[model samples]
Target: MHVARHKWRSSKTAQRGVEELNAQVARHEGRVQIVNPEGLHPLATRPTLREYISQLWARRFFITADARAKALRTTRDYRLWQLWLVLNPLFDVALYGFLFGMLLKTSRGIENFIGFLFIGIIFMSMMTGLMNSGISLMQSSRSMIRAFQFPRASIPFSTTLRSMIDNVLPAIVALLAAFLFQWGTWPSWTLILVVPLFILIHIFGCGLMLITARLTAQIPEAKTILGLVSRGLFFLSGVMFSIDRFAEHSAVHQVMSANPCYIFLTAVRDASIYRTAPSLATWGELVAWSVGAFVLGFIFFWRAEDKYVRLV
Candidate 1:
C-alpha cells in the first residue's frame, strides 16, 4: 500500500508540473514565440511613407529601363518608326489649322496661328498622354504588381517618363515645322526657358497621374468618366484657337484665362514661338498648379500603398 501511494503521488506531481508550465506559457507577456513557417511574415506588412519613398528611389533604374523598353516595343511594329512621331503631330496641326484657321477664321486676331496651333496640339498631347497613363497605370501593371515586389507608384512614374521621352521627338518636329513654315521664328535665348517649363509640366503631370491612378484602381468605371471629362477639357484648353478671342465676354475670358492648360500652353508659345519671356502671372500659375497638385497627389497615393495589392 505504501509503495502504490508513493507512485501515485509522484504521478500527481508530474501532472501538476505540466499544468504549471502551460500556465507559465499562457501568462508570458514578452516572450518571442516562433512563427509558423508557412504563416504570413511581418515583412508583408505595409511600409512607412519614408520607406516607400526610399524604395522608389532605389528602383529608379527599373523605371528608366522599363520606360525605354516599352517605348521601343510600341514603335517596333510601325515601319516608319520614329517618323510617325513627327508626322502624327503635323497631321493633327493641319487638321485643326484647316478647321479653326480656315473654316471658322479664328486666326484673325492671333499672330502666327499655325505656330500657336502647333504649340497647343503638342502640349495638349503630352498632358493627355500623361493623364491617360496615370488612369490606366494600375490596370496595365497588374501582372508586374502580382509578380514583383517593387513600389507600385513606380508604374505611373515610369509611364510618365515614357510619355515625356516619346514627346521629345514630337516637340522637336513641331518646333522645326513652326520655323520651316514661317509659322514661328528661329529659336532664341528665350527658348532656354523651355527646359524649366517642361519640367514644371512634368511635375504637374506626375501629380495628376498619381491621383488618377488611385481613383481608377478603386473604381474602374472612373476611367470612362474621366475620358469624357478630358474631352470637355480639350475644348476649354484653347488647343485649336486662342482663348483670348472670347475676351469680349468677361466671364468666359476669366474662366479660360484662369485655365491651367491655357496658362501652360501660352507660356510655351510665348517662349518658343514669340521668342518672349512668359509673364510673371503665367509663371506663378504654372508653379502653383504643379506644386500644389504634386504635393496633394503624392500624399494621397502614398497613404493607400498597402491597399493597392489587395485592391488590384
Candidate 2:
C-alpha cells in the first residue's frame, strides 16, 4: 500500500509539472518568434476577422472547384442528359413555347413568341437557379460542412458557379434560337460585353447565395419560405411577360424598378435583345448589393463555422 501511494504521488507530481510547463510555454510564446511559412493554426476561441478572411482566400480555389464539380456532376446525372449541354435549354424553350405561346398567347405582336420567350425564360431561369440552389446550399452540403474546415463563404460561391455552368447551355440555345427565328437579330457585336455582365450577375448570385445559405443553415424551415418567395420573384422579374408593358401602373413600375431581379433581367435583355448596356444606376445598385451581401454573409456564417461540425 505504501509503494502504491508513492507511485500515485509521483504520477500526480509529474502531471502537475507538465501543467506548469505548458503554462510557462504559453507565456513564453508571447516573446518567441515563429518562422512559420504556413501560418499558425487558428484557435476556435478567438479568431480575428481578418485572419479568418485570409484563411478563406487561401483555400478558396480548391474548395470552390471541388464544390462546383460536385454540384455539376449531380445536376448532370439528375438531368440524365450527358449531352445536357444541348438538351437542357432546348427543353426549356419547348416548355416555354407551350406555356407562354399556346397557353398565355401573350406573344402576339412579337413575330415569334418562341424566340422571345426562349430568351426571357432562359435568362430568367439563371437567376432563379441561383436563388433556388442557394437557399438549399447549406443543407445540401451538411456533410461537407462537417468534413472540411474551409470557409463557409466558399459554399455559396461554389453553388453559384455550378448554376452558372448550367445556365451556359440555355444561354447558347437562346442565342441560336433567336437567330434562327429572327425574333431579334443577333445582338450588336458590343453584346460580347454581355459576358462580363453575366459575370456580375453571377457575383450578385453569389451574394444572394451567401445570404440564403446563412439563413437556411441556421433554420431549416426557412427553405420552404424561400421557395415561396422565389416563386413570387419569378413572376415579378418578368420571366413570362415584359414589364415594359406595365409602365402605366405607377405602383407596379416603382416596385419593378426597385427589384434587383428586374434590373438584372433588364440588363441581360438589353444586352441580348436590345443590344445595349445595363443602366448605370442599376449597375451601381447591383454592385452595392453584391458587396454588402458577401461581407455580411461571410461574417455571419464565419461566426458559426466552428459550431457547424458539432451541429452536423
Candidate 3:
C-alpha cells in the first residue's frame, strides 16, 4: 500500500509539472501576459476604433476620396462667389432654345424643345469633361506626378469624377424639366441603370485619358488633333437626334450604330427616351470597351510612367 501510494503521487506530480511547463511556455511566447503594471498577469488588448477606421480608409478609399475632395473644393469656390454650378448650362440652354426652338422654329412638332436641349447638352457636357480631363491630366498634373507616388491613373479618374459631380445640378435640372414638360416620360426603373452605365463610361474615359495624356505630354500637336477629333465625335455622336429617326435609312443607321459613343449615347437615350432596357449588344459592347480600354491603357501608361517626371 505504501509503494502504491508513492507511485500514484509521482504520476500526479508529473502531470502537474507538464501542465505548469506548458503555461510558462505560453507566457514566454506572449500568448499569455506574464507581468502586469502591478507586477501581476496582464490581459491582451485589441485595436482601437480609430485605428480600425484608419486602416479601412487607407485601402481603396484614395480613388473616391481624392476625387470627392477635388469636386467639393471646386464647388465651394463657385458657391462662395454666389454663382451656381448650373447657371452656365441653364444660360446656354435658354440661348440655344430661343435661337433653335423659337427663332428658327427648328423643334417643329417637338412638344418640349427645352427638355430636349437639356438632355443633349448635359450628355455633351459630361462627355466633353470626361474626354478633356483625360487628355489634359498629364499636363495639368505635372508637378503632382513628379512629387507623389500614388497611382498616376487616379489623377484623371479623380478629374472625371470631379466634373461628373459638378454636373449633378444640371442632370437634376434636366430630368426635372423633362418630367415637368412631359418631353419624354422616362421610367424611373430604366433610369436606375444610369449609375452602372456612367461608371463604365468613367472607367473607359479614364483609360483613354491616360493614353492621350501620355501621348499629348510627349507631342504638343496631339492636343490640337484631339480637339478636332472631339469636335467630330460630338457631331457624329447624335446628341440632337433620336436613333429612331434614322432607323428608316439602313446605311446611315448602320454607320451611326457602329460608332461606340453613339451606341453608348443611344443606350442612355433608349432608357430615357423610350423607357426601355437597351439591347444585349449595347451592354456587351460597353463591357468589352471597358475591359479592353483598361488593359491597354494600363500597359501603355505603365510604360510611360518612368518618363513623366523627366518631361515635367
Candidate 4:
C-alpha cells in the first residue's frame, strides 16, 4: 500500500510540472507587451504618415547641412570647379538656341526669344537634376542608412536642396545673359516674385525626388528607364519652344501647358522678362502642384521606408 502511494505521488508531481511548462509556453506565445517611454513599436516597419513627417521635421538641420556638403563635394573635384555651374547652362542655352532658333526657327515669333530660352533651360535643369539625383539617392545613401536612423525622405530632400544651391550661380548668369541678349528688361518690383516662384519649384522638385527615390529603390532597373523618360520630358516640357505653337491641338497644348516645368518656366518669364506678376491662375497651379506632390510623395515614400534598408 505504501509503495502504491509513493507511485501516485510521483505521478502527480510529474503532471504538475508538465502543466507549469505548458502555461509558460502559452504566455510566451501571446502578444508581446513592450513597455517604454517611446511606446511599443516594431523596428522593421514604417511609421504612420503623421509620425513620419514629424520625424522628418526633426531632422531639418541635418538635411540642410548634408545638402551643402554634397554640393561642395560634387564641385570640389571638377576641373573647372564652380565655373561649370555657370558655363554648363550657358553651353546648353547656346546648343538649344542653335537647334531650335537657327535650324527649326521656332524662336522667330517670340519676343525676347533669348530670355525665354534662358529661363526655360535654367528652370528645366533644376527639374532634370532633381529627377536624376533621385534615381541614385537611395544607392548613394546606403552607407548612411546602415549607420544612422533617420527619415529616408531626407536623402531626396537634401538632393533637391543641393540642386537649388548649385543653380544659384547659373541663375545669375542666365539672368545676366537674358538682359545682355535683350531678353530681359531692367529689374522691377515684379522681379521680387521670382523668390516665391523659386520656393514653389523647390517644393515641387522635392516631391518629385521623393517619388523617384522610392521607385528606384523598389525597382533597381527603374533608374535607366527614368533617364530615358526624363529626356523625353525635356522635349515635351517646351524648354526650347513655345507651347503656344501647339495651341491648335487642344489636347497636346493642355498636356504641355499643365506640365510643372512649363508652368514654372512661364512664371519665371512673366516675372523677369515680361515684368509682370504671375496671374492668379498661375499661382494657384504652382501651389496645387507643389502641395499635392509633396504630400503624396511623402506618404508614398514613408509607406516603404522600412523596405529601403532591405533593398540595399
Candidate 5:
C-alpha cells in the first residue's frame, strides 16, 4: 500500500509539472501545441482571414483554369454550342411572350413590351443561373473537394467565374437587341453603365455562390430551399411584368423595391432599356447589395472552411 501511494504521488507531481510546462509554452492558451519535429505529421488549422484571402489569391490561376474548363464542358455537349447562349434567351422570350403577353396580357400598358420582357428575362438569367450554380456545386464538387487539398471557397469562386464567362455574349446580345429595337434610349450614353452593372451582378453572384455553396454543403436539403427562394425572387423581381401591377402602397411594391434582385433588375433595365442614367439611388442600392453580399458571404463560407470535406 505504501509503494502504491508513492507511485500515485509521483504520477500526480509529473502531471502537474507537464501542465505547467505546457501552460508556459502556450502563450495565448493554457494548453500545449505539439509540433511533430520529425515531419511525419503535418498540422493545419483554419487560416486567419488575412491568410485565407492570401491563399485564395495565390490559387487564382487554378480557379481560372477550372472555370474555363467548366465553361467549355457546358457547351461541348450541345450541338449548337455557344450559339445556344443567344438562342436560349430568344426561345424564352418567345415562350414567355406567348404565355404572358398574349395569354395573360400582362404587357397591356407597358411600352415596347417585347423589349421590356427581353431585358427582364435575359438579365434576370444571371440571378437564376448563379443560384443554381451555387447550390448544385456542393453536390457535384464533392469528389474534387474530397480528393484535393485546396481551399473549398475556390469551387464556388470558379463557378461564379464560369457564370461570368457564359454571360458575356448573352449580355452583349441583350444590349444590342434592346438598342436596335428602340426599346431603350437609342442614342443614350447610359448604356455604358451596363458594363459596371454586369460586373456588379458578377460580384453579387459570387457572393450567392459562396453562401449557397456552404449552406448546401452543410445541409443537403438547402438545394430545395434555394429553389423555392429562386422562384420567389423571380416573381418578386418583376421579370415577366411590371411591379406597378401592385398598388404603390401595397406589400409587394414595398418588398420588391427593397429586394436586392428587384433593385438590380431595375437598374439594368434603366441602363439597358430606358436609355436613362440610373439614379444615384439605384447605383447606391446596387453597390450596397453587391458589396454587402460578397463580403458577408465570403466570411460566412470562411468560417466553416475546415469542415467542407466532411460535411459534403
Candidate 6:
C-alpha cells in the first residue's frame, strides 16, 4: 500500500513537470496573455499577410480536397452527369459554328475555321466560368464561410482549382476537335505549347476569381450583373471569329485586339489549331496578366478579408 502511494506521487510529479514544460513552451511560442481582454482578438482572428500566406500554404491539401469534392458534385444535378462537360463544348461549337460560321460568315478569312472556333469557344468558356463562379462564391459558400475561420482567399483559390479540374476534359476535347475537324496531322511540338498556355490562362482566371469575390462581398447585387459582364467579355474575346471582323471600326478593333482575353484565346489557337508559335508578345501579355492580376487581386482580397465573414 505504501509503495502504491509512492508510485502515485511520482506519477503526479511527472505530470506536473510535463505541464510546466508545456507552459514554458507556450510562453516561448508567443501565447497571448489576457491582461485586459479588450485588446484580445478571437482565436481565429485574421493573421498578418505573411502568416496568412503560410496558412494558405499549410492548407493546400484542404484546398485541393475541397476543389475535388466540389468538382465531383458540380454536375450531380444534371441527368447526364459528367457528359455535360464534354457536350457543353460541342453544343457551343455547333451553335456558334452555325451562327458565326454559317450566317455571319466570320469564318471567311481564317484557316481551319472549325478548329479555330472550337478552341476559342471552349477556352473562353473557362475564363467566363471562373468569373461567374467567383462573383457568386460568397453566396454559394455562405454557410461554410460563417461556420469556419479559414483564410477567405481559400474560397477563390479552391474555386480556381475546381475550375482547372472540371476543364480538363473540355480542354482535351477542344484539342481533339481541332484535330478531327481541321488540323489533320500528327501532333507537333507547337501543340505542347498549349499546356503552358492553359496553365497561365487558369492562373489569370484565379486572379479574376479573387477580384470578383471581393467585389461580390462588397456589393451583393453586383452578382446579378456580373454574368452579363462575363458574356460581354466573351463576345469581345474573339471566341467565334477573328478581330479582323472589327476592321471597319479601327478603334474597336484595336481595343479588342489588345484585350487580354483576346490575346489568351489567340495564343491557344495559334499554338493548337494553327500549329504556329505564339508571338513573344502573346506570351508576355499572358504572363503579365496572370502574375500581375494574381498579385494585385490577392492584396485587394486580403484587404477585404474581414468583410467577407459579414457578407450575407
The best candidate in terms of TM-score: 6
Q: Judged by TM-score relative to the true structure, which candidate is superior, 3 or 5?
A: 5
State which candidate, 4 or 6, has the greater TM-score. 6
Q: Tell me the whole-model lDDT of each prediction, alpha carbons only.
A: 0.83, 0.71, 0.68, 0.84, 0.83, 0.86
Worst-scoring 10-residue span by lDDT in model 1: 176-185
lDDT of 2 by residue, 104-169 (tens): 876766644566677777777777677777676677778877676676667676677677776766
1-312 in candidate 4: lDDT tens per residue?
999999999999999999999999888866876678676676667888788889889999999998888774566678888777777788999999999999999997798899889988888888777777788788888998888888888888888888888777777777778777773358778888988887888888888888889899889899899999889888888888888999999999998888888888888988987788988988998999999998888888888999888887
Q: Report lDDT (Cα) of residue 250, candidate 6.
A: 93
Candidate 1 local Cα displacement, residue 1, angstroms: 80
Q: Return the lDDT, model 1, position 233.
A: 74
Candidate 6 ranges beyond 4 A from true positions: 1-39, 42-45
For model 3, where is the 10-residue window of minimal lDDT? Answer: 41-50
Model 2 poorest 10 in a row by lDDT: 70-79
* lDDT of prediction 4: 0.84
Q: List the residue pairs that clash in candidate 2.
A: none
Clash list (residue pairs), candidate 1: none
* TM per prediction: 0.83, 0.76, 0.70, 0.83, 0.83, 0.84
TM-score of 4: 0.83
Candidate number of the best lDDT: 6
3 versus 5: better lDDT goes to: 5
- Candidate 4 worst ten-residue window by lDDT: 179-188
- The list of candidate 1 runs beyond 4 A from truth reads 1-44
Comparison by TM-score, 1 against 2, better one? 1
Scored by Cα lDDT, where does model 5 land? 0.83
Task: Give lDDT: candidate 3, residue 217.
Answer: 77
Report the lDDT tens digits of candidate 6 across residue range 54-116: 989999999999899888567779999888878888998999999999999998898889888
Error of 4 at 308 (Å): 0.9
